[model samples]
Target: MTISLSKDEERDFDREIRPLAADPRCQRMKRFIQHGRITTYEHSMNVAREAFRLNREWHAGADERRLITAAFLHDYFLYDWHTHGDRLHGYHHPRIAAENAGRDFRVSARTQKIIRSHMWPLTLFHVPTSREAWLVTLADKICSARETLFERGSGAGHR
Candidate 1:
């Protein structure tokens, strides 16, 4: 079953994501698929929500703004990786995402690290070096598994 956010959670989520969401480039993700059955927009939303929840509930001492922004931007690469098959998406998308984010937003170095390293073990050497980066990485994996396995129907990009 799908979980719905409370009003307060929804408000906070909207507030935190407003800057990124306001951009047409980021908004276009609503049409791009990620994982198996979710849009990149949905997948990134899940990661940002979970990363915020973990930081708030667990008191991870990470920079809250950076965590939320980076989580949202961690998959901001604009293409459907499934169709663009020349390279391994998992191994390379983080860097591409970081580049896109840097171009589209005023990202801090920590935010860049968070985006570049969220792929974690898949990327090997691109390790998460900050508390925020670690949270984003873990949250991304969790959200990815849920999107890939539990969600239904491929997103609009496949069609």
Candidate 2:
């Protein structure tokens, strides 16, 4: 079955996702994007889009809301991992993102787990248990890494 959001459903998605994107915790992310550093919004959208692509390609029957929510908010912490001092982001940001997400959104248990465990083999120490969670995690990594690399290359000669 091909599932796609209608215009009204897309509007609802924007309404639901925008508040989280506008939160104070997420402000740092917005600022980064505004400064042409890297875009949390774009990165997030890419992850969600990529996840949907993967699902369509693999014919994976995943919950669309859970997958999209997890993909969009996976890096809700909005901190620059490169400046974490001791590289704590690999082991810390997931918890921070999860806590903030819990406070801001009525996240499902599975969605929360995906947010909390997306940093697998690092802080999570375990892989995501659900297909939706796993898809979000993989999408997050793919998007984040690509963005990070692009930013690094573009900024290499400037700094």
Candidate 3:
């Protein structure tokens, strides 16, 4: 679950991603745990940071601003889904996140699409239709898997 960025990457993160991620509501995500030992805020930062690195490495044509913004807001469901009593959290959080992000930030349609489709395959019909969306999806899975499988119990808490 460690987000390892080089100096230049850190500069990129600070310059490109930190401002929006510093939003008050976004900061509140620090209170909620995502997978295993990571806070939702930490997880979102990891995703966005990684997405930016990937975009640089791959020249993937994904819009950097949109990708970072969407990554930060992809899990903006704003609650601990594990304890929310929602039976369909996996299928539903993406849309909830999309709505909340749009309402709060006036994100573009492309960013909304990235947030709404990041949990694809589990979300089934909501396939990623853009390069940025696909990168967010892949980054989410990688970060989630690493957090859940390799970093479990360091700070894990029960719902």
User: Which candidate achieves the best TM-score against the true structure?
Assistant: 3
Q: What is the C-alpha RMSD of each candidate to the true structure, in Å?
A: 3.4, 5.8, 3.2
The TM-score values for the models, in the order shown, are 0.88, 0.71, 0.91
- Give the number of the best model, judged by lDDT: 3
Q: Which pairs clash in the backbone of model 1?
A: none
Tens-digit lDDT track of model 2 for 49-136 = 6676676568788777787778778777766556556466667877777776777777877787888888786764657888887788
Give the alpha carbon lDDT tens digit for every residue of 1-159 in model 3.
457778987887788777887789899888888876678988898889888888878989887889899998999999998899999998999999999999999998878999999999898899999999999999999888877766654365545
Give the per-residue lDDT of model 1 (tens digit) for 1-159.
Answer: 133566886788778888777778889988888866688887887888889888877888888788889999999998988898847888889999999888878797778988999999998999999999999999998888876767654333331
Model 3, backbone clash pairs (residues 3+ apart or across chains), number: 0
Clashing pairs in 3: none
* TM-score comparison, 1 vs 2, better candidate: 1
- Output the better candidate (2/3) by TM-score: 3
Full-model lDDT, candidate 1: 0.84
Q: Which stretches of candidate 2 lie over 4 Å from their true place?
A: 1-28, 33-36, 83-86, 152-159
Candidates by TM-score, descending order: 3, 1, 2
